[model samples]
Target: MTGKPKLYYFDGRGKMESIRWLFAAAGIEFEEEFLETREQYEKLLQDGDLLFQQVPMVEIDGMKMVQSRAILSYIAGKHNLYGKDLKERALIDMYVEGTTDLMTLIIMYPFSSAEDKEKKRAVIIQKATNRYFPVYEKILKDHGQDFLVGNQFSWADVHLLEAILMVEEKKSDVLSEFPHLQAFKARISNIPTVKTFLEPGSQRKPVPDDKYVKTVKRVLQMSF
Candidate 1:
Protein backbone atom coordinates (compact mmCIF):
# COMPACT_ATOMS: atom_id res chain seq x y z
CA MET A 1 0.00 0.00 0.00
CA THR A 2 1.05 3.56 -0.49
CA GLY A 3 2.37 4.75 2.87
CA LYS A 4 0.23 7.82 2.38
CA PRO A 5 -2.02 9.29 -0.26
CA LYS A 6 -0.45 11.52 -2.89
CA LEU A 7 -2.15 14.76 -3.88
CA TYR A 8 -1.36 16.79 -6.97
CA TYR A 9 -2.36 20.43 -7.49
CA PHE A 10 -1.16 23.95 -8.11
CA ASP A 11 0.85 25.48 -5.30
CA GLY A 12 -1.98 27.70 -4.21
CA ARG A 13 -4.28 25.95 -1.70
CA GLY A 14 -7.40 26.43 -3.80
CA LYS A 15 -9.70 23.39 -3.57
CA MET A 16 -6.94 21.24 -2.20
CA GLU A 17 -6.61 23.17 1.03
CA SER A 18 -9.87 21.91 2.44
CA ILE A 19 -8.92 18.37 1.47
CA ARG A 20 -5.58 18.84 3.19
CA TRP A 21 -7.26 20.05 6.33
CA LEU A 22 -9.62 17.09 6.15
CA PHE A 23 -6.71 14.70 6.03
CA ALA A 24 -5.13 16.46 8.97
CA ALA A 25 -8.37 16.39 10.97
CA ALA A 26 -8.65 12.71 10.19
CA GLY A 27 -5.07 12.14 11.31
CA ILE A 28 -3.96 10.76 8.00
CA GLU A 29 -0.48 11.23 6.62
CA PHE A 30 -0.19 12.28 2.99
CA GLU A 31 2.39 13.64 0.61
CA GLU A 32 1.93 16.41 -1.93
CA GLU A 33 3.49 17.29 -5.30
CA PHE A 34 2.75 20.85 -6.36
CA LEU A 35 2.72 22.24 -9.89
CA GLU A 36 5.50 24.74 -10.38
CA THR A 37 4.38 25.87 -13.79
CA ARG A 38 1.41 25.64 -16.11
CA GLU A 39 3.43 23.52 -18.50
CA GLN A 40 3.88 20.85 -15.85
CA TYR A 41 0.15 20.68 -15.18
CA GLU A 42 -0.73 20.58 -18.89
CA LYS A 43 1.71 17.78 -19.48
CA LEU A 44 0.15 15.78 -16.64
CA LEU A 45 -3.31 16.45 -18.04
CA GLN A 46 -2.29 15.44 -21.54
CA ASP A 47 -0.75 12.26 -20.21
CA GLY A 48 -4.19 11.25 -18.90
CA ASP A 49 -3.23 11.44 -15.28
CA LEU A 50 -6.24 13.61 -14.57
CA LEU A 51 -9.53 12.00 -15.63
CA PHE A 52 -11.45 15.26 -16.04
CA GLN A 53 -8.32 17.12 -17.17
CA GLN A 54 -8.31 19.26 -14.05
CA VAL A 55 -6.35 19.31 -10.86
CA PRO A 56 -6.78 18.89 -7.06
CA MET A 57 -6.39 15.18 -7.71
CA VAL A 58 -5.42 12.46 -5.26
CA GLU A 59 -3.94 8.98 -5.54
CA ILE A 60 -4.99 6.49 -2.94
CA ASP A 61 -4.09 2.79 -2.86
CA GLY A 62 -2.83 3.21 -6.44
CA MET A 63 -6.25 4.42 -7.63
CA LYS A 64 -6.49 8.03 -8.76
CA MET A 65 -9.28 10.41 -7.77
CA VAL A 66 -10.44 13.82 -8.97
CA GLN A 67 -13.00 16.30 -7.74
CA SER A 68 -12.18 17.75 -4.37
CA ARG A 69 -15.61 17.08 -2.82
CA ALA A 70 -15.58 13.44 -3.89
CA ILE A 71 -12.16 13.05 -2.38
CA LEU A 72 -13.40 14.72 0.80
CA SER A 73 -16.47 12.52 1.14
CA TYR A 74 -14.31 9.46 0.54
CA ILE A 75 -11.82 10.51 3.17
CA ALA A 76 -14.46 11.46 5.67
CA GLY A 77 -16.13 8.10 5.28
CA LYS A 78 -12.89 6.24 5.74
CA HIS A 79 -11.72 8.34 8.65
CA ASN A 80 -14.89 8.65 10.74
CA LEU A 81 -15.20 12.38 10.20
CA TYR A 82 -18.49 11.75 8.40
CA GLY A 83 -20.70 11.26 11.47
CA LYS A 84 -22.44 8.38 13.18
CA ASP A 85 -25.47 7.56 11.03
CA LEU A 86 -27.69 8.22 8.05
CA LYS A 87 -29.63 11.11 9.60
CA GLU A 88 -26.40 12.94 10.32
CA ARG A 89 -25.18 12.06 6.84
CA ALA A 90 -28.20 13.81 5.34
CA LEU A 91 -27.54 16.97 7.27
CA ILE A 92 -23.82 16.81 6.51
CA ASP A 93 -24.51 16.60 2.80
CA MET A 94 -26.81 19.62 2.96
CA TYR A 95 -24.15 21.77 4.64
CA VAL A 96 -21.46 20.54 2.29
CA GLU A 97 -23.54 21.79 -0.62
CA GLY A 98 -23.95 25.11 1.11
CA THR A 99 -20.22 25.48 1.58
CA THR A 100 -19.73 24.77 -2.09
CA ASP A 101 -22.12 27.58 -2.93
CA LEU A 102 -19.88 29.98 -1.03
CA MET A 103 -16.67 28.41 -2.32
CA THR A 104 -17.60 28.89 -5.97
CA LEU A 105 -17.37 32.65 -5.61
CA ILE A 106 -14.09 32.56 -3.71
CA ILE A 107 -12.48 30.39 -6.35
CA MET A 108 -13.55 32.73 -9.17
CA TYR A 109 -11.82 35.82 -7.84
CA PRO A 110 -8.56 35.27 -9.68
CA PHE A 111 -9.68 34.77 -13.27
CA SER A 112 -8.97 38.38 -14.19
CA SER A 113 -6.80 41.37 -13.38
CA ALA A 114 -6.60 42.81 -9.89
CA GLU A 115 -9.32 45.40 -10.51
CA ASP A 116 -11.92 43.01 -11.86
CA LYS A 117 -11.14 40.44 -9.22
CA GLU A 118 -11.71 43.02 -6.50
CA LYS A 119 -15.02 44.15 -7.96
CA LYS A 120 -16.32 40.59 -8.03
CA ARG A 121 -14.74 39.86 -4.67
CA ALA A 122 -16.55 42.75 -3.04
CA VAL A 123 -19.90 41.67 -4.40
CA ILE A 124 -19.30 38.07 -3.39
CA ILE A 125 -18.10 39.16 0.02
CA GLN A 126 -21.31 41.02 0.63
CA LYS A 127 -23.56 38.18 -0.50
CA ALA A 128 -21.66 35.49 1.32
CA THR A 129 -21.65 37.32 4.64
CA ASN A 130 -25.11 38.75 4.51
CA ARG A 131 -27.10 36.00 2.88
CA TYR A 132 -25.31 32.67 2.98
CA PHE A 133 -23.32 32.82 6.20
CA PRO A 134 -26.38 33.53 8.29
CA VAL A 135 -27.88 30.25 7.19
CA TYR A 136 -24.85 28.43 8.58
CA GLU A 137 -24.98 30.53 11.71
CA LYS A 138 -28.53 29.46 12.35
CA ILE A 139 -27.67 25.84 11.74
CA LEU A 140 -24.97 26.07 14.33
CA LYS A 141 -27.20 27.98 16.69
CA ASP A 142 -30.10 25.59 16.27
CA HIS A 143 -27.95 22.54 16.81
CA GLY A 144 -26.59 24.11 19.97
CA GLN A 145 -23.47 22.06 19.56
CA ASP A 146 -19.88 22.60 18.56
CA PHE A 147 -20.56 21.11 15.09
CA LEU A 148 -23.07 21.15 12.28
CA VAL A 149 -24.44 17.60 12.35
CA GLY A 150 -25.22 15.62 15.46
CA ASN A 151 -23.35 16.31 18.66
CA GLN A 152 -20.06 15.16 17.22
CA PHE A 153 -17.71 16.92 14.86
CA SER A 154 -18.34 16.13 11.22
CA TRP A 155 -16.80 16.89 7.84
CA ALA A 156 -19.53 19.46 7.36
CA ASP A 157 -17.92 21.55 10.06
CA VAL A 158 -14.51 21.19 8.50
CA HIS A 159 -15.80 22.24 5.11
CA LEU A 160 -17.58 25.24 6.61
CA LEU A 161 -14.39 26.34 8.31
CA GLU A 162 -12.70 26.38 4.94
CA ALA A 163 -15.43 28.62 3.51
CA ILE A 164 -15.34 30.85 6.59
CA LEU A 165 -11.61 31.44 6.26
CA MET A 166 -12.02 32.52 2.65
CA VAL A 167 -14.70 35.05 3.53
CA GLU A 168 -12.76 36.28 6.54
CA GLU A 169 -9.71 36.95 4.42
CA LYS A 170 -11.57 39.22 2.02
CA LYS A 171 -13.16 41.21 4.83
CA SER A 172 -11.93 40.77 8.36
CA ASP A 173 -15.35 41.66 9.65
CA VAL A 174 -17.00 38.81 7.80
CA LEU A 175 -17.99 36.96 10.97
CA SER A 176 -18.84 40.00 13.06
CA GLU A 177 -22.53 39.19 13.11
CA PHE A 178 -22.29 35.43 13.43
CA PRO A 179 -21.07 34.54 16.90
CA HIS A 180 -22.06 30.90 16.59
CA LEU A 181 -20.14 30.67 13.33
CA GLN A 182 -17.18 32.35 14.97
CA ALA A 183 -17.32 29.72 17.68
CA PHE A 184 -17.71 26.99 15.09
CA LYS A 185 -14.58 28.17 13.32
CA ALA A 186 -12.74 28.17 16.64
CA ARG A 187 -13.71 24.54 17.31
CA ILE A 188 -12.54 23.40 13.87
CA SER A 189 -9.29 25.29 14.21
CA ASN A 190 -8.66 23.87 17.66
CA ILE A 191 -8.32 20.37 16.23
CA PRO A 192 -4.70 19.24 16.42
CA THR A 193 -4.80 17.88 12.88
CA VAL A 194 -6.38 21.06 11.57
CA LYS A 195 -4.26 23.56 13.50
CA THR A 196 -1.14 23.05 11.42
CA PHE A 197 -2.97 23.94 8.24
CA LEU A 198 -4.09 27.27 9.70
CA GLU A 199 -0.96 28.21 11.58
CA PRO A 200 1.46 30.92 10.51
CA GLY A 201 3.74 29.85 7.62
CA SER A 202 1.18 27.31 6.49
CA GLN A 203 0.53 27.20 2.72
CA ARG A 204 -3.16 28.01 3.28
CA LYS A 205 -4.31 31.07 1.35
CA PRO A 206 -7.71 32.72 0.97
CA VAL A 207 -6.98 33.35 -2.69
CA PRO A 208 -4.51 32.39 -5.35
CA ASP A 209 -1.24 34.25 -5.04
CA ASP A 210 1.96 34.88 -7.04
CA LYS A 211 2.69 31.18 -7.43
CA TYR A 212 -0.62 30.57 -9.16
CA VAL A 213 -0.59 33.66 -11.40
CA LYS A 214 -0.12 31.50 -14.49
CA THR A 215 -2.40 28.73 -13.34
CA VAL A 216 -5.68 30.56 -12.57
CA LYS A 217 -7.00 31.06 -16.11
CA ARG A 218 -6.95 27.29 -16.59
CA VAL A 219 -8.66 26.33 -13.34
CA LEU A 220 -11.17 29.21 -13.42
CA GLN A 221 -14.04 26.97 -14.52
CA MET A 222 -13.21 24.13 -12.19
CA SER A 223 -16.27 22.58 -10.55
CA PHE A 224 -14.16 20.84 -7.92
Candidate 2:
Protein backbone atom coordinates (compact mmCIF):
# COMPACT_ATOMS: atom_id res chain seq x y z
CA MET A 1 0.00 0.00 0.00
CA THR A 2 2.97 2.30 0.24
CA GLY A 3 3.98 2.20 -3.40
CA LYS A 4 1.68 2.33 -6.41
CA PRO A 5 -0.39 -0.75 -7.19
CA LYS A 6 -0.05 -2.31 -10.64
CA LEU A 7 -2.88 -3.72 -12.73
CA TYR A 8 -2.76 -5.85 -15.87
CA TYR A 9 -5.68 -5.93 -18.25
CA PHE A 10 -6.84 -5.11 -21.74
CA ASP A 11 -7.70 -1.51 -22.52
CA GLY A 12 -11.37 -2.44 -22.35
CA ARG A 13 -13.56 -2.75 -19.28
CA GLY A 14 -14.67 -6.37 -19.79
CA LYS A 15 -13.91 -7.54 -16.23
CA MET A 16 -11.55 -4.99 -14.77
CA GLU A 17 -13.41 -1.72 -14.50
CA SER A 18 -14.60 -2.29 -10.98
CA ILE A 19 -11.03 -2.87 -9.93
CA ARG A 20 -10.20 0.44 -11.53
CA TRP A 21 -13.17 1.99 -9.77
CA LEU A 22 -12.00 0.62 -6.45
CA PHE A 23 -8.57 2.10 -6.86
CA ALA A 24 -9.98 5.40 -7.94
CA ALA A 25 -12.61 5.45 -5.20
CA ALA A 26 -10.04 4.74 -2.53
CA GLY A 27 -7.83 7.49 -3.95
CA ILE A 28 -5.19 4.85 -4.35
CA GLU A 29 -2.36 5.28 -6.83
CA PHE A 30 -2.02 2.48 -9.37
CA GLU A 31 -0.22 1.75 -12.62
CA GLU A 32 -2.03 0.11 -15.52
CA GLU A 33 -0.37 -2.27 -17.99
CA PHE A 34 -2.72 -2.77 -20.88
CA LEU A 35 -2.37 -5.94 -22.95
CA GLU A 36 -2.68 -4.60 -26.47
CA THR A 37 -2.77 -7.89 -28.31
CA ARG A 38 -3.75 -11.52 -27.93
CA GLU A 39 -0.13 -12.38 -28.60
CA GLN A 40 1.07 -10.40 -25.59
CA TYR A 41 -1.53 -11.96 -23.33
CA GLU A 42 -0.66 -15.40 -24.64
CA LYS A 43 2.97 -14.75 -23.87
CA LEU A 44 2.09 -14.02 -20.27
CA LEU A 45 -0.03 -17.15 -20.15
CA GLN A 46 2.82 -19.23 -21.46
CA ASP A 47 5.16 -17.61 -18.98
CA GLY A 48 2.83 -18.52 -16.15
CA ASP A 49 2.67 -14.95 -15.01
CA LEU A 50 -1.08 -15.27 -14.69
CA LEU A 51 -2.44 -17.91 -12.33
CA PHE A 52 -5.64 -18.07 -14.37
CA GLN A 53 -4.04 -17.09 -17.67
CA GLN A 54 -6.17 -14.02 -17.88
CA VAL A 55 -5.70 -10.33 -18.62
CA PRO A 56 -6.91 -8.86 -15.34
CA MET A 57 -3.99 -9.67 -13.13
CA VAL A 58 -2.74 -7.36 -10.38
CA GLU A 59 0.35 -6.77 -8.30
CA ILE A 60 -0.28 -5.51 -4.81
CA ASP A 61 1.70 -5.77 -1.61
CA GLY A 62 4.48 -7.09 -3.87
CA MET A 63 2.46 -10.17 -4.83
CA LYS A 64 0.60 -10.92 -8.04
CA MET A 65 -3.05 -11.88 -7.98
CA VAL A 66 -5.91 -13.00 -10.26
CA GLN A 67 -9.68 -13.15 -10.28
CA SER A 68 -11.54 -9.86 -10.65
CA ARG A 69 -13.97 -10.35 -7.82
CA ALA A 70 -11.30 -11.29 -5.31
CA ILE A 71 -9.25 -8.29 -6.24
CA LEU A 72 -12.30 -6.08 -5.98
CA SER A 73 -13.16 -7.47 -2.58
CA TYR A 74 -9.60 -7.10 -1.36
CA ILE A 75 -9.40 -3.51 -2.51
CA ALA A 76 -12.82 -2.82 -1.05
CA GLY A 77 -11.94 -4.31 2.27
CA LYS A 78 -8.73 -2.35 2.37
CA HIS A 79 -10.45 0.91 1.49
CA ASN A 80 -13.54 0.49 3.71
CA LEU A 81 -15.77 0.16 0.68
CA TYR A 82 -16.70 -3.30 1.84
CA GLY A 83 -19.52 -3.66 4.34
CA LYS A 84 -18.83 -2.98 8.00
CA ASP A 85 -19.82 -6.36 9.41
CA LEU A 86 -20.05 -10.08 8.63
CA LYS A 87 -23.78 -10.01 7.89
CA GLU A 88 -23.39 -7.00 5.60
CA ARG A 89 -20.58 -8.79 3.80
CA ALA A 90 -22.82 -11.79 3.24
CA LEU A 91 -25.47 -9.62 1.62
CA ILE A 92 -22.83 -7.82 -0.41
CA ASP A 93 -21.49 -11.15 -1.65
CA MET A 94 -24.95 -12.20 -2.77
CA TYR A 95 -25.45 -9.05 -4.85
CA VAL A 96 -21.95 -9.33 -6.22
CA GLU A 97 -22.64 -12.87 -7.43
CA GLY A 98 -25.82 -11.69 -9.10
CA THR A 99 -23.87 -8.97 -10.88
CA THR A 100 -21.32 -11.53 -11.99
CA ASP A 101 -24.07 -13.70 -13.44
CA LEU A 102 -25.47 -10.68 -15.24
CA MET A 103 -22.00 -9.86 -16.56
CA THR A 104 -21.56 -13.44 -17.77
CA LEU A 105 -24.67 -13.29 -19.93
CA ILE A 106 -23.74 -9.94 -21.49
CA ILE A 107 -20.09 -10.83 -22.06
CA MET A 108 -21.09 -13.93 -24.05
CA TYR A 109 -22.76 -11.90 -26.77
CA PRO A 110 -19.44 -11.06 -28.38
CA PHE A 111 -18.10 -14.61 -28.41
CA SER A 112 -20.52 -15.92 -31.04
CA SER A 113 -20.58 -15.45 -34.81
CA ALA A 114 -22.07 -12.24 -36.10
CA GLU A 115 -25.22 -14.11 -37.08
CA ASP A 116 -25.23 -16.21 -33.98
CA LYS A 117 -24.26 -13.17 -31.98
CA GLU A 118 -27.50 -11.43 -32.87
CA LYS A 119 -29.57 -14.47 -32.04
CA LYS A 120 -27.88 -15.00 -28.73
CA ARG A 121 -27.83 -11.29 -28.15
CA ALA A 122 -31.62 -11.11 -28.09
CA VAL A 123 -31.78 -13.68 -25.36
CA ILE A 124 -29.04 -12.02 -23.33
CA ILE A 125 -30.67 -8.65 -23.63
CA GLN A 126 -33.97 -10.10 -22.42
CA LYS A 127 -32.28 -11.57 -19.39
CA ALA A 128 -30.16 -8.55 -18.60
CA THR A 129 -32.72 -5.83 -19.12
CA ASN A 130 -35.79 -7.78 -18.13
CA ARG A 131 -35.16 -10.97 -16.22
CA TYR A 132 -31.88 -10.16 -14.48
CA PHE A 133 -32.59 -6.52 -13.84
CA PRO A 134 -35.90 -7.10 -12.09
CA VAL A 135 -34.27 -9.39 -9.58
CA TYR A 136 -32.14 -6.48 -8.41
CA GLU A 137 -35.10 -4.16 -8.67
CA LYS A 138 -37.07 -6.24 -6.23
CA ILE A 139 -34.09 -6.60 -3.91
CA LEU A 140 -33.43 -2.90 -3.97
CA LYS A 141 -37.11 -2.27 -3.38
CA ASP A 142 -37.31 -4.68 -0.46
CA HIS A 143 -34.03 -3.60 1.12
CA GLY A 144 -35.11 0.03 0.90
CA GLN A 145 -31.48 0.89 1.23
CA ASP A 146 -29.33 3.25 -0.80
CA PHE A 147 -26.88 0.46 -1.59
CA LEU A 148 -26.99 -3.30 -2.06
CA VAL A 149 -25.77 -3.95 1.47
CA GLY A 150 -26.50 -1.08 3.77
CA ASN A 151 -26.98 2.68 3.82
CA GLN A 152 -23.39 3.30 2.78
CA PHE A 153 -21.90 2.36 -0.55
CA SER A 154 -20.12 -0.99 -0.85
CA TRP A 155 -17.83 -2.69 -3.35
CA ALA A 156 -20.71 -4.87 -4.47
CA ASP A 157 -22.64 -1.77 -5.43
CA VAL A 158 -19.65 -0.52 -7.35
CA HIS A 159 -19.41 -3.79 -9.27
CA LEU A 160 -23.09 -3.82 -10.11
CA LEU A 161 -23.11 -0.15 -11.07
CA GLU A 162 -20.16 -0.58 -13.41
CA ALA A 163 -21.87 -3.56 -15.03
CA ILE A 164 -24.98 -1.48 -15.54
CA LEU A 165 -22.97 1.31 -17.18
CA MET A 166 -21.26 -1.15 -19.49
CA VAL A 167 -24.65 -2.29 -20.78
CA GLU A 168 -26.02 1.25 -20.99
CA GLU A 169 -23.23 2.25 -23.39
CA LYS A 170 -24.42 -0.23 -26.03
CA LYS A 171 -28.16 0.04 -25.49
CA SER A 172 -29.00 3.11 -23.45
CA ASP A 173 -32.61 2.26 -22.75
CA VAL A 174 -31.98 -1.13 -21.17
CA LEU A 175 -32.60 0.20 -17.67
CA SER A 176 -35.78 2.09 -18.49
CA GLU A 177 -37.96 -0.33 -16.62
CA PHE A 178 -35.81 -0.63 -13.49
CA PRO A 179 -36.28 2.57 -11.58
CA HIS A 180 -34.58 1.19 -8.47
CA LEU A 181 -31.42 0.25 -10.32
CA GLN A 182 -31.57 3.54 -12.16
CA ALA A 183 -31.56 5.42 -8.89
CA PHE A 184 -28.87 3.14 -7.54
CA LYS A 185 -26.58 3.61 -10.51
CA ALA A 186 -27.07 7.36 -10.42
CA ARG A 187 -26.08 7.45 -6.77
CA ILE A 188 -22.92 5.42 -7.22
CA SER A 189 -21.92 7.25 -10.39
CA ASN A 190 -21.78 10.43 -8.38
CA ILE A 191 -18.97 9.23 -6.12
CA PRO A 192 -15.98 11.56 -6.45
CA THR A 193 -13.47 8.97 -7.59
CA VAL A 194 -16.01 7.32 -9.87
CA LYS A 195 -16.87 10.70 -11.36
CA THR A 196 -13.20 11.26 -12.13
CA PHE A 197 -12.74 7.79 -13.60
CA LEU A 198 -15.74 8.40 -15.91
CA GLU A 199 -14.43 11.65 -17.30
CA PRO A 200 -13.39 11.75 -20.98
CA GLY A 201 -9.74 12.16 -20.01
CA SER A 202 -9.71 8.91 -18.06
CA GLN A 203 -11.17 6.66 -20.75
CA ARG A 204 -8.25 4.88 -22.40
CA LYS A 205 -10.10 2.35 -24.51
CA PRO A 206 -11.80 3.28 -27.74
CA VAL A 207 -15.31 2.24 -28.45
CA PRO A 208 -15.02 -1.45 -29.20
CA ASP A 209 -16.63 -3.18 -32.21
CA ASP A 210 -20.15 -2.16 -33.10
CA LYS A 211 -21.03 -5.73 -34.01
CA TYR A 212 -21.46 -6.44 -30.32
CA VAL A 213 -23.28 -3.19 -29.74
CA LYS A 214 -25.65 -3.80 -32.61
CA THR A 215 -26.31 -7.26 -31.29
CA VAL A 216 -26.96 -5.86 -27.85
CA LYS A 217 -29.33 -3.26 -29.24
CA ARG A 218 -31.14 -5.93 -31.16
CA VAL A 219 -31.38 -7.92 -27.98
CA LEU A 220 -32.92 -4.95 -26.24
CA GLN A 221 -35.57 -4.86 -28.90
CA MET A 222 -36.51 -8.35 -27.73
CA SER A 223 -37.52 -9.35 -31.25
CA PHE A 224 -35.19 -12.34 -31.43
Residues 14-51 of candidate 2 have per-residue lDDT tens digits of 56766777788777878887665556666778778789
- Compared to the true structure, candidate 1 yields what TM-score? 0.88
Candidate 2 lowest-lDDT run of ten: 215-224
- lDDT tens readout by residue for model 1, 94-150: 889888888888776765566687788888788887778989898878868777888
Error of 2 at 118 (Å): 1.9
Best by lDDT: 1
Candidate 1 backbone clash number? 0
lDDT of each: 0.80, 0.74
Q: How close to the true structure is residue 202 of candidate 2, measured as C-alpha lDDT? A: 76
How many clashes does the backbone of model 2 have? 0
Backbone atom clashes (below 3 Å) for every candidate: 0, 0
RMSD (Cα, Å) for all candidates, in order, is: 3.0, 6.1
